[model samples]
Target: MPFINLKTLLRRESVGGALLVVAALVALIWANSPWAGGYEAFRSFTVILPVHAWAADGLLAIFFFVVGNELKQEFVRGELRHPRRAVLPIVASVCGAVVPALIFAVITFGHGDAAGGWGIPMATDIAFAVSVLAVVGRGLPPALRTFLLTLAIVDDLVAIMVIAVFYSAGLAWAPLLGAVAGLALFGWLQQGPMRRGPLRQGPLTRGPLRRGPLRRGPLRGLPQRQLPMKIVLVPLAVLVWTLMHESGIHATIAGVALGLLMRTSTLPGETISPSDRAEHLIRPWTTAVILPIFALTSAGVTVTGAGNLLASPAAIGILAGLIVGKIVGIFGGAWCTTRFTRAELHPDLTWPDIFGIAQLAGIGFTVSLLIAELSYPNDLGLLESAKAAVLLASGIAATLATVTLTLRAARHRRRAPDPAG
Candidate 1:
């Protein structure tokens, strides 16, 4: 491969999954080291909110923004454009979430306080899951990634709803109304006079900048363009995010709302839609910088009370939910949906592929840690223990998925038509 292509593959591909693990490992080591006090102090230090809070709310919101964009694109022109294809992920995502919550609740039963953390394992960290697939799944059907993406997106939506409804400290109506109005405006602006397909929008459709020879002016040589972001876009986005935060709505929803509302059709004179362009521009940054930073801050759990963490109902619930509940829920839901409904697995895939993907879903890291932070704000010991368990479960899930997917890919490779023919 050329240098640029190789560089891009590293930055944009499954290598990020490995990077996430490295960052978390660094944090875990630091937190449990002789300098553990430094980690705690840094974690607790605040500007407006503590370091962990900013990571969970602010950094993770950026991550979800990309997810929202993916969700909209899939709905617009990808696998989700058809009802038959969409049903599998939608059902499986729900079952995947519900089963984990049920398991967590059952495990934590008789302890009402610990049971509140039931929401922790109900999420799948798509970044980790997709990246893991990309890394170890060389000869696997491409459709498997699509299936994983669709399932993860649906479950992400479910997770967002859970945070908004079940986890919010208290709902404040006025700011929420303002947030709704702001989001509406954003959608309207992006969808401006657009139709089924690409149409004219910018300078090309208007004034002197329309097809012509170079005009004589100081700015004549420059390509004519709009700068709405500098003028209104960024401020409007900040205002919406602030309103959502003020409304006690788990501010990440603002990212999802804006992302879902993005117009996915290209405008005339553009090669790609605005959403794709934004994702292309932002995804690498989020994957490389934002996710690792969030991991560093949130995964820094001291292991002084290892025995206590093992015994804690909250921690045990998280472990059981991700390790067991996710696989059973996701795979079972998928199997039933395919068996009973008209929908079927892609021709390129098989049950083993689905099983591997289901196992990947068990790697709940980013959103899981965020929910853990939300679920036990008052109980520091419980919070750390839960976070520790999330790290542990995610690590184990990643290992299991690697073994399964690697074997599946090897089998597929062995069965391939010989290029020597």
Candidate 2:
């Protein structure tokens, strides 16, 4: 195969996903090697705060921020605009989350304190899933990818709610209120100084709305005065993150809150909305740096006893939840929704396609690792087993999905109609 250009490769979602994997592999190896002591020391070394916590609390928030923006756009002007197209993903996300938690609970039922990790496998890492799809999903129905994206976004919101309610420390009402106020201000600023032209008349309605989080030229359509507005937004955003952190909720929730409040529709002269620009500006950093750092710090598990970890309930629960539970949960949920409810799958797609996509949904790396940390804050041994289980399960999920989607793609191509007639 001919090599692609460096710039183009860097821009691909697969590249960032590859980096995250490589970082985790390096960390895992380092943690298990003879230099394990040094790895532990480095992970423990801090500058007035925990380095790993920064990756979890601060860096991951940037990823969630872009996700928040994507969710806003989809709900307002994208696939989520039509109620018919929206029903499947919404229902699937809820069922997908619930089933995994239930699986984890069943496995860890009698194990004291291990049940806290029931939330670890309840979420999907869309970044990894999308990359896997992009590489091997050629000739498949376009609806499959759309379904995955929509389902993941809604799934993220569900996961965020779980974290806020289950994982947070004692609530501090004053700071929580301050975070809410700051988010409101951020939303107000997103409105911009420009007024909306008549909705049904003119360029505002006719302009094509660009999608995706990491597109370049985000500032191309904005006015010069709007450039300086970042100064104010930056400080305000930090204030919100800080307040949310102090409020005993996860700080990443602040990013999601601010993202949801962004204005999705473009103003009179602008081609891009404030939400789009923010995503464009922040997505690259989140992908190239934040995710890799998070994987490095969180994925380092020193596997001293593989047999014991395999026997452990928390580990067994995570594996079962991601690999087995996700498949049964999401695919079963999709089937029941279309079968029982008025909702229908796209005419172009098949049940098998949904099954494959559900398999991909099990690659719950970044968020699962974070939840593992939160689930076993004081128990190093349990945390290690859980982290190992997550990595192993995600790899299995990715491999299975790849094989399933590749076969499906071949079948899709074979059935495609020719236009020569």
Candidate 3:
């Protein structure tokens, strides 16, 4: 429940972003090199699932789980606990998504089947955006970072909704029902009746058996000892995910569902809630292993025909949406919020700071690639073009953000009194 300051969070995300870039670069090199055929073979080779599917479905589920946990914690106990504090970023996030999709649609409408790829530009890669901010806007206020975090979190939640509702295959009723039941049970188990007795202190201590005044009904019969969370929770989570996967809804939805349903609070004696423990255990794995693996497999767009790829309608639409739409949508949304509501930008920040952050939000690397693959599943050329566009747009966005932020930082430094004074 301790507050992690913004700088610390940005530092952690920057590390992940660096790893992601490295992995993606390696993939691009390997895919375009003479070893391209071997890379394709390895990715297509199936165990229980194709290697690419494992990276996208299995590993990415862990990443989404962490995302869900963070969002839930924010809503339940962090900056988003208050509605007034949360509304600006939520509005900004919505506009950010809507404008990009609209731009993509308009740009690709006349092209064959390219309009379906509208969702590709709507996502903001939180890691990459935060990394850019950390590197170039170190002098910026922490509140700016918080705003970016909130915006990204809401953006991710919207992206998940789009994937679940738009991208999923036709539903299989039986497994769908099973997935629902499993999710409900998971929620119930985590919401186990609140402890009644004077809560025990410390992580390891067991609660007293005798009921106290604080003790309530229904939970009275339960033993004071903590439930075997691993034995009960893990299997149920797996069951839900499997059912969800078989139901033709992306399996990652199950991860988000379970994470949102998890308890953010535990009894006084408990060391950590399921949400905290799970995030702590898997965060490093997701950052260092899962995401890198995904990048290695998914970012390998063979750019043999670089000019053709860049000139493709899909690529043009994606680039336009990311580079132009994101900045307009995000900044416009924030400007409108300030104009119409009591919400305001941080005292230390200027319009230029918001613009820079908006530019960085265009770095829609991971989620954009996922949406691209889903959008053009049957068209290899289109998929490759879309992926290349994402890389290009992300790079351009990062560069613009870096320049703008550095100038802004330098301006602030100049206006400050010298330390020798």
Candidate 4:
């Protein structure tokens, strides 16, 4: 019954995803309509600020700040904290990333300029994937959710590196230095005197302490907690954004790095859970605002003719890389790791279940779109084509995975002899 409330919000994510799908369709139709010019204008239309730099830089910086918060939450307490528990998904994520990139690189071999798009297929859009899991009914387990979340976080880390290393334009050392400085500042905030000060005061305690030595009270050994470090780190992250933008690296990378560095774990003895604090602060803004806006802006596409779709190499490469690469990499990596390490699969799941989940991992819409934007900022035609292919591939992958998993689970239930008999 307690989860009934949680289920409502979860259901809304799925519903919101459906709306996004509709919006993408509308954008496509509008782009191909007589009002095509209007569609283009909508994308290019800027919200101007009195300060040009703020308009150009500030909005995206907020986007990255949200990203930083998510990354911190994951590393501090989410999935990445326990290395053994994390190994399966981490391995799968690496394989998922490396194999898709290699596949994309091989396909786009001659087009050196477009090869930077290799990262396009490396990410798993957690929102979309979670939505699919929700739709796949009761076949999936909580452990699978944990597994996928961890895998996606690692995938994002890899994707961020790919953007920083491969997609960045001519590097300006100054901005890179500034980004590094920002990260250092975040790290210091996590471990330095500031974090310790709150912990020293002990865990939050209500009411006044009793007088005398007893005044130390029931909370005498209460661990200290840090003030929300984001107060300081946020401004610094914005500065990093400016520098990264100036240096020609995509500013989002700064957000990802700052997130990873600043999300230090509170020790078991600590009063407050750092991961809880970070997630509580970050998840809503990122989910509700940053990601959706990014989707709306980047997912716009025009599929005017079949010829345009067929001719676009980036589109073909991305779709194939995601649909094919994710299934192969996830299933193969999971199988190999389990066999070699003899690790136990989740009790309720089997090989078929793992394979089905792997198939769902192909839903790469969000990260794929982001990469498409970075890869083809000047080539709207290529970007649109890629967007279309990503949507189509993701649809097929989700459908097939959902159907297969549902049937498999049903069969599993049916085959078990009734214990009552």
Candidate No. with top lDDT: 1
Clashing pairs in 1: none
lDDT, candidate 3, at 354: 84
Worst 10 residues of 2 by lDDT: 207-216
Candidates 2 and 4 compared: the better one by lDDT is: 2
Tally clashes: model 1.
0
TM-score per model over all chains: 0.84, 0.81, 0.80, 0.70
RMSD of each: 5.3, 7.4, 5.4, 6.2
- The top-ranked prediction according to TM-score is 1
What's the true lDDT of residue 404 in model 3?
Answer: 88
Local distance difference test values of all predictions, in order:
0.80, 0.79, 0.78, 0.65
Query: In model 1, how large is the Cα lDDT of residue 102?
Result: 96
Q: Per-residue CA lDDT of candidate 3, range 147-236, in tens?
A: 787788678778867876798675789999999999988888786543333344444443443322334555443334444667787899
Q: How close to the true structure is residue 276 of candidate 2, measured as C-alpha lDDT?
A: 81
lDDT of 1 by residue, 40-157 (tens): 9988999989998887778778877887888788788877777777788778889999999999999999986788899999999876687788778889876677788778877877
User: lDDT tens digits, residues 1-421, model 2?
Assistant: 2333544455556577778778878888999899988888887888766888787778877777877777778778776667766798779878898999999999999899888899999989876687688778889977787788778867776886788788866589999999999988888877764232222233433334322122225444332222345778889999999899888777877877777788888765467777888876676666678778877887787665355566789989999999988888899988899888888887788999999999999988878877888999998878878887888888899999999999999999999997775
Among residues 3 or more apart in sequence or in different chains, the pairs in candidate 2 whose N, CA or C atoms overlap within 3 Å are none
Runs with alpha carbons beyond 4 Å of true place in candidate 3: 1-11, 130-146, 163-169, 193-223, 344-350, 377-380, 405-421
